[model samples]
Target: MNIKQPDWEAIERAYRAGALSIRTIAERNGISDTAIRKKAKAAGWERDLSEQVRKEVRNKLVRGEVREDQCANPERDAEIIEEAAEEGATVVRSHRRDIRKATNLANLLMDDLLNTIQRREEIEDEIERETAGDESGFRRSSMLAAVALPSNAKTLFQLSSAMKNLQVLERTAFGLDEKEKSADADELSSLIDELSKDA
Candidate 1:
């Protein structure tokens, strides 16, 4: 069996240059990417300047000072700008979607808290009936009993703080909190007035 030594000097030069990806460099040197990564980490190699290079190129494109090499094709500039814009919009939409999901979860928690407080006795009775004595010990019923209700002042305070934090997140996600009259509210008020007139 014959073993060949890897060119460490060439590898170091390529790694420090930060032009080729680690995988590519490792493949060229006939080594694993993990081996190159370990060597790079041990040597404290500088990060790739690809992001910086792209930023500089983007700035130049925005200023209409693109180099001939950059715009090898006439439509490259437009494509790059369009791609960047789509990437930015995707990030924003993803952020908004996550915020919306968090807000929905918070709203559900609030509702659960309110329901448990208002109908504690009824809910407890339901649970008890569902879990009635069985010799076989087959009591399979849990209607949110696992969810601990805030009993003491400390727990209540914590819940309040969490709700307040959710409120702040909601405000930041969507603009400031507004108390606009909803159509449902107006319709309900109209129905009440009509019933009063009939009576």
Candidate 2:
């Protein structure tokens, strides 16, 4: 029967140095957990408990939150940087002033965009009101132009009312026409036809 023996020296050095997981070391050395643990014990190696505890504490620090010791506590920040150096990880700090400026600029741009949308809606509403008033006037004028029929004219009131409406609509059209660079002539022609229907 053959008994397997693990390389104790390598396992001891890795354990004392606070290296990656036992699984990672196992993969690197092409060995199993039982072999690594047995070898570590044989070499009198103890895990760097402080390094492990520090790792757990740092994991709770949410990414991008300004670290308390980044500038305020040099000792704490130095310790953090040293720990990171030992782990071969980079430490980066962001400029608070630059972040604040970016936040303000983003807020300003959002406000400007919202104001622009509101103004556009207001302009659209005004144009719609003008167009509706113009159309109503046109219809009134067409009905009025149809003229009188009999002494007991039933439709006389309706015709006169339509003509009066057209006169008012023609006035409203001028205001709406000036708002845009170009007016749709076809739409004006359609309004005229609608006005003349009763005539």
Candidate 3:
């Protein structure tokens, strides 16, 4: 009588590796998953460190936070690079939103400043018209003297300073300093390339 014995040792190794499902491993080895499970249970088989590391890397990749060392293969490296690019794009879009908001605020401030100046000019014109026939120029001088600072002058100054500061900050955030002409996109792309090379 001849018996075709199964290589239980190899089966156990594959089971502990945890890369393949029990069902798939069983099919490859020409056995039932139940049989493999029974043997694994009897032998006290548990997933090895590689399996644990793979799981951890998988979780981190999904969150776009996997380090290059954790996923050190071409396929996994591509996945991580793509994830990083997506994260970078999201950041860029957010920066764009900030830029738009800052620009809108500046536009509003400019509009208000123009309106305030126009109102001031109108007030001055009205005073001049009222005193047009004053041969002594006394009333015009007195009225002009009573005119103190414009009501929105302080606000206009503050807004102007704030807008200028905001523009500087925006430029800095994007690596757009006058000395550095390179764009943020280039930095982000190079970052992705470096990650891939490290992997």
Candidate 4:
């Protein structure tokens, strides 16, 4: 029997995206539930239906459709209630971890942005000093304009425009455009020759 290997990453992503059931994931992937469960355990994936159930209960309660006591069966659903509570705690911890990771990433990006701004300012000052005696003022003004920071809205707009332009350039460069055109042999040869000259 040829056993197909499951894509563990895909399975894990699906699980994280709220699939949350070993049997459900296994059935979807045509794998054994035990295999899925093992992989999830190894990946430290948490399953929490309590949060979802709580939200649903809250909504229903607000609409006067269900009472608080009806949320769980005290006798028959004791084990399920305990499991949900434990999983709910796990979910809260997981969310806190995710928030920390996001905060760290934001800090790192902010540092990089500040460094870039500082470097740009240093370069501008150097250029200004160099062009101080030029008398033309054209070079200084042009360089300053080139490095000028835009207002928040303008910055967002410029970034969006730049991203679109980059996407277009990439498509054309990689011959992934609708025309599916690539560089001719002569162009390719010329590029190779130019690169070889640098060597």
Question: Best by TM-score, which number?
Answer: 3
Q: What lDDT does candidate 1 reach at residue 43?
A: 89
Q: How well does each candidate superpose onto the true structure, as a TM-score?
A: 0.36, 0.28, 0.38, 0.32
In order, candidate lDDTs are: 0.53, 0.43, 0.58, 0.51
Q: In model 2, where do residues sit more than 4 Å from their true spots?
A: 1-8, 52-84, 91-199
Mark the regions of model 1 whose C-alpha exceeds 4 Å error after superposition.
1-82, 132-199
List runs of model 4 lying over 4 Å from the truth.
1-68, 124-199
Put down candidate 1 lDDT per residue, 1-199, tens digits, no spaces: 8799898867765554333456666887999989987987998755333232333333443443433354434354334433433333344345557667776876776676677677877776776776676454334333534433635334457667877886776574343563443233224324323433433
Please give the TM-score that candidate 3 achieves against the real structure: 0.38
Clashing pairs in 1: none
Arranged by lDDT with the best first, the candidates are 3, 1, 4, 2
True-structure lDDT of candidate 3:
0.58
Arranged by TM-score with the best first, the candidates are 3, 1, 4, 2
lDDT of 3 by residue, 1-199 (tens): 9877778877765565444456656887888999998888888776432323343333443453434454435454444344434444454446557777987978887896677566776777888999999898988877755443654666678788888888876775454673523233234334434433433
TM-score winner between candidates 1 and 2? 1
Every model: Cα RMSD to truth: 19.2, 29.5, 17.5, 18.8
Model 2 misses residue 134 by how many Å?
A: 30
True lDDT of residue 21, candidate 3: 58
Give the lDDT of residue 66 in candidate 1.
31
lDDT of 4 at 157: 63
